[model samples]
Target: MDTLPDPVGSSQMDIETSQAGGTPEVANSAAKPRVRAPVRVEEAPKFDLDTYIANYTGRTRYDRLYLIGTCSPSLANEALKAAIAEAKASKDIIKYEKAVRALSEVAPSDPEATLNSAWVQETQRSVNAQTERLEGELKGYKNNLIKESIRMGTEDLGNHYYRTGDLAAASKAYSRVRDFCTTPNHITSMLFKMVSVSIERGDWLSVQSNVHRLRNSQSKPEDAARNEPKIAAAWALAQMQQGAFLEAANSFLAIPADLGDSYNEVLTPNDVAVYGGLCALASMNREELQRNVLDNQSFRNFLELEPHIRRAIAFFCNFKFRPCLDILESYRPDYLLDVHLQRFLPQLYKRIRTKSIEQYMIPYNRVTLDAMAKIFAPSVIGGEAKPTDISSPFVQELIGLIQDGVLDARIDMEKGLLISNQVDLRSEVQRSTLENFREFNQEAHWRILRAQVLYHGLEIKSDKKFGDGGKGARFSREGAGFD
Candidate 1:
């Protein structure tokens, strides 16, 4: 077997011998192939590209790019290629810029090689210029690089914009936040945000739609506790906007104090008070107001936000007509200017006034006109208030209510009193029963008489026809043969 020459020591000795003037050609011939020691380069730990990118939330996009570009040229190339492919597929200029920048950093030119360092720098500069040109496109893409984070972050940013009153921009930003929410709470939160935006834009239909979503979602207990009041408030506001006062009032009253206290963005506590109080006054009876509004602990908590409204409701429920009207009158300006309450104010006040009249007269057989006027009239606050007379608008309104059957009483102008139209239940029932019985008896007598007439008429006709000479009549009675 042929052996290989020693390349290390022999090559050095041949150089020494040739320098020492020994025959140069013989020294060179005597030199063996140098066997160099094996190189031991410490390889860097390989980066798992899939694992790194999979966990990447675009927050660290630039950082990751720097790490790959500086530490691992191969991984940088892989990242760049992946980014390029994504950019092309998605038509994202930001990703394209990222790819260019990464490539320039990863592959710098070597001067000793055919491609000089200056050429490399020039190429890098060109890539950088292109990247800078596309940098403006990168502003929104950072969040979007990671799907989940983007959705939530976009929602937060949308809310910020909404709060700042950039409504159009806010809506546009929110539209980009797709509802990829995983939990019920998250879904409800998304819906609430949408509702808030709708409310801002006065898009009541959209608000109601989102409110429906919030209502149907089954949130966690904590989330429900946190979110239910806001949802209720939004629903009530939307209903009020639509002039569905009855439903809106119920929704407002349903909001728990804790939630109501926490949520003031859409409806203040005072607004809730006026809304619920007025709605109850308009649609519900005194009994309902007592039961559903004044007596309800949760709803009362909300009303406590505006104590006067609560007082008004209590007064109305307790049949203090004058006091209730006074309290409502005091808040007239506030209610008049309220976005939700203003539209309903006049109707609501009228209902309260009518109810006051009805309830005031409920137990009385007769009330003086002066007394009725005193209860129904809005009293002047500061000066000596005039005694409201029968000819006043207050009395006129009461008269109208009575005529409309809203108040089941009659005003006697000559007697100068309000007379309650009381019907005796027992007497009415007995009279109705007696009338029915008499009608039934007459009907039975008529039926009997008509039957008798029909029977007699038939009998007479038969006798006349069957007088002994009538053959047709004679053949029918006995079992005789027809001749």
Candidate 2:
């Protein structure tokens, strides 16, 4: 009756009212709430110090502060002190965090950075006390290793000295270590060191003794085999020094083939060439042996070990005149040259000159020229030339003055008298001259010819004739004259 005013609108209202309280429709029409799914987050990657330090460019203030803190303790402290002061001025969070991280990293190593003037002395005292306590705790452990390590340390020091060319120091240091070390490596090292020192000092017997010890030692099989060539070489040198060439040759031949290969591998090219030359000299038929050696790949490989030595060997082997001249001109007393000269000078001279006397004559001329050139320009030549300058300067000058007539008659006469006196007083003009010439030419009378030539040039012109018939004719015929 109350809703009779709008029956048209009331029809829809009556339908809603009838449905509002109905149990079956209300329960069925209830709305359901939506729920969200769980979110997934990834963890950050691990930090690496080397990478961080490597790429640390100071773009931001924090980055700049981090860089200063990580480099060194003193730098970190200085940066942190300034940063703390600046932080107090502005109360910046970034500045404060940077300062705190820096202080934490550097505080253990550098107390001064963390402690201001007000607390500096106390902090230092605390650090010193802590350091002393830690050091005291570690001392007992350190002392235990010292005695056991001393010999090894000293031996290593000796090897370092030897490598650096301080042979005398190395010898002494090695000797000291040798006395303390009894192990197989130590004994072998000591023997090798002694042998090296003896070789350098030219003590053949000592080298032999050390080489024997090295051979007999309880060294590793490889090391023992590796030492064979050196031992054999040393033994050969000792026998040679004792004037036993055949024995030396036998000793040299006793060296294993593999030992030579090992020696070649370890030695410098120059050393290989020198040793090969020595080994070649030890053979009964050196030319044939050398040909064989040169043809062998192993020996050629040895020659390839050092450019300088290889060049020298090639020059010597091929008889390359220019290379030999260059080597002589350069004036190094190389071991290869020494050994070759000792072993093959007679053969080389005969092959080149085709006469024994001419072979003798060549070295006489070489010695005279060398002595004269050395006196005229001392710095131009070295080794034997330098010593010859010291030993024969007056003789050289007398020859020069006499030949040139540069000195007055009185001075010339005096120089002549002085030469005659030297010849008389020392008997060295005859003896040493002969000995040096023989050593140079490997001939007995090489110096006698040299001296005769020197006297003839000094006393008489080549074209001049001097004689009182038969008596003077005897002297002239004998290639002796007085003007």
**lDDT of each model, Cα atoms only?**
0.59, 0.44
Off by over 4 Å in 2: 1-147, 163-165, 220-222, 237-245, 259-483
Cα deviation of 291, candidate 2, in Å: 14
Residue by residue across 308-405, what tens digits does model 1's lDDT show?
88888788777787888887776675454343454467777877777777788777778887666556653522222443445566667777887788
TM-score for all models, in order of appearance: 0.54, 0.31
Write candidate 2's Cα lDDT for 1-483 as tens digits. Answer: 111101001122223533676322112211111111111112211223333233222112232333334333434555455545543343222234335444655564654344354333443354345435544543543466564466666666555444322345557667777666767877886877777655543456877778777878888898777776767666766765555544654554454445443332123233344445444433324244445555555555545543454464345455443453354334232221232123333343223222211212222212343433433334555645443333555445545544554322122232223222112334546898888877877443655665776767643333335345433433332355221
Best candidate per TM-score, number? Answer: 1
Alpha carbon lDDT at 390, candidate 1: 57
Per-residue lDDT for 161 in model 2? 43
All-Cα superposition RMSD per candidate = 30.3, 35.2
As a whole number from 0 to 100, the lDDT of residue 377 in candidate 1 is 52
